[model samples]
Target: EPEVTQTPSHQVTQMGQEVILRCVPISNHLYFYWYRQILGQKVEFLVSFYNNEISEKSEIFDDQFSVERPDGSNFTLKIRSTKLEDSAMYFCAGKNGQRSTDTQYFGPGTRLTVL
Candidate 1:
């Protein structure tokens, strides 16, 4: 079965540098999303994209953040300026266009740690 994959399972970065988290969503899926989980918080949706444009986005997706499908198989999230509060598990997910009951398959996640 195809699955979402993320790179650099764990990353430690400075408080003001930039970081790019990579993901390869399941092939054939049409909806992709990015979510984040703070150490003890529930998963929070950051953004969702389809047809090469953003479908929906939450307040968490601010000016410092951006996402793109750089190629047919790769989707990437870039953070222009990291902050200490940015430490969290960044999850990449995909849905098979089943809107009625879409189940998102999530990657293991890239733990971003800013200090």
Candidate 2:
């Protein structure tokens, strides 16, 4: 079975530092997304990407954040400047392009700790 994969499983950064998190989704998936769960909070969608452009985004994906599919296999999220409030577990998810009702498969998540 295919699954989503993320790198740098954990990261710690200073308040003003930039951070980039990476992920690789199941090969046949066509939709990709980023979601975050602030410590003790529910998971919230940040953005969605398809056809190599952003398809949808939430209020949380402000100017400080960006997403990219640098290549055929990798998707990434970058924070221009980290904030203590940004500390959370960031998840990368995807769903197969062939199935409109397919459940999204989520990566294990990258834990970001901003100080």
Candidate 3:
């Protein structure tokens, strides 16, 4: 079965550094989303993209964050000038978008540590 996955299972970076988190979501999925979970906090939606365009974004996804489908197959998230508060597990999720009840699948997530 196809599944979503992220690269650099773990990453460590200094504050103000730039980081590009990559996600390889199920190719057949029509809708893709990005979420983050701070160490002890619950998951929060960051952004959603479809048809290679950003459909929605949460307040958490500020000017420093960007999402793209550079190759029409890979989903990528980039955080510029990463801040200490940016440290967290970033996840890539997707759904068929064919029905409201469609199950959303999520990747194991990439652990990002900003010091």
Candidate 4:
């Protein structure tokens, strides 16, 4: 079974700076997504991509945040400007359409610390 993976397990950025988080979803998966968990908060859905387009996205994924697949193997989330409140553990996930069972695999997560 293939698994999702995120780069730079941990990232530290300054407020008002730009940051890009990268993820590689399961090669066979049809849907790719991103989620974030703020300290002491529940995991929140950020965005989902399918067929090279955005399938869905939450309010948290505002104009400041963008998602793209620059290449066939990489899905990326970019924050144009960082904020202190943006500090969180970002997790990348992928789900394949399995008639028997729908399973979403997650990456270890990239911890973003903004100061």
Candidate 5:
């Protein structure tokens, strides 16, 4: 069985500082995504990447945010500037194929704390 993994499991930063969250998905997966969940809130989709390009994105993924697959194995999300409201659990997810029944595996998540 394969799963997603993230680095820097927890991050604490001052408001306005930058942060980069990283993840590695299953090697054979064809789709990758980034999501966030504010404390006690619903999981929100931030962006989805395929073929090294953004396939989908939500309003939450504004100019201040960006994502990159710097290499074949690593996917990264960067926030140019952090805000108190940006504090949340960021998850990396992936799916092997685009099927309604395909399972989307999720990483444990990186907890970002903005102070």
Candidate 6:
């Protein structure tokens, strides 16, 4: 089965830096989303993109964050400036549509660590 893949399963960065988390979503999937789990906290939705534009976004998606489908198969999330609070496991997810209650398949996640 096709699956979402993320790079650099683990990353260590300073408190004020830039990071680009990469993801390759399922080939045939159309809906893409980004979610983050801060250690033991609940998984919070960051943003959702479809048809080359944002479909839905949560408040957590602040000015420092951005996302794009750089090409047919690659989806990326860029953080302009990192903060201590930004350290979390970022998960990339993709879904076909809402036909089946919008089930999202998540990647193993890229664990971001800030010091």
The candidate scoring highest on lDDT is: 5
Give the Cα-based TM-score of candidate 6 against the true structure: 0.95
Could you tell me how far off, in angstroms, the CA of residue 108 lies in candidate 2 after the best superposition? 0.1
lDDT, residue 86, candidate 2: 94
lDDT of 4 at 68: 91
The TM-score-based order of candidates, best leading, equals 5, 3, 1, 2, 6, 4
Model 5 Cα displacement at 20 (Å)?
0.5
TM-score of each: 0.96, 0.95, 0.96, 0.94, 0.97, 0.95
Q: Name model 5 segments beyond 4 Å from true.
A: none
Give the best candidate by TM-score.
5
| Cα lDDT of model 3 by residue, 4-98, tens digit | 98998999999999999998889889899999999999999999898888999999999999999899778999999999999999999999885
- How are the candidates ranked when ordered by lDDT, highest leading? 5, 2, 3, 1, 6, 4
Give the whole-model CA lDDT for all candidates, comma-separated.
0.93, 0.94, 0.94, 0.92, 0.95, 0.92
lDDT of 6 by residue, 60-100 (tens): 89999999997878899999889999999999999989566
Name the weakest run of 10 consecutive residues (lDDT summed) in model 3.
95-104
Local accuracy of candidate 5 as per-residue lDDT tens digits, 23-109 = 999999989999999999999999999999999999999999999998899999999999999999999999989887998999999
TM-score winner between candidates 2 and 3: 3
What is candidate 1's lDDT per residue for 1-115, written digit by digit as tens?
A: 7879999899999998999999999998889999999999999999999988888999989999999997878999999999999999999999887576989899999999999
Residue 45 CA displacement from its true place in model 6, Å: 0.5
**Candidate 2 CA-lDDT value:** 0.94
Q: How many clashes does each candidate structure show, in the order listed?
A: 0, 0, 0, 0, 0, 0
Candidate 3 lands at a TM-score of 0.96
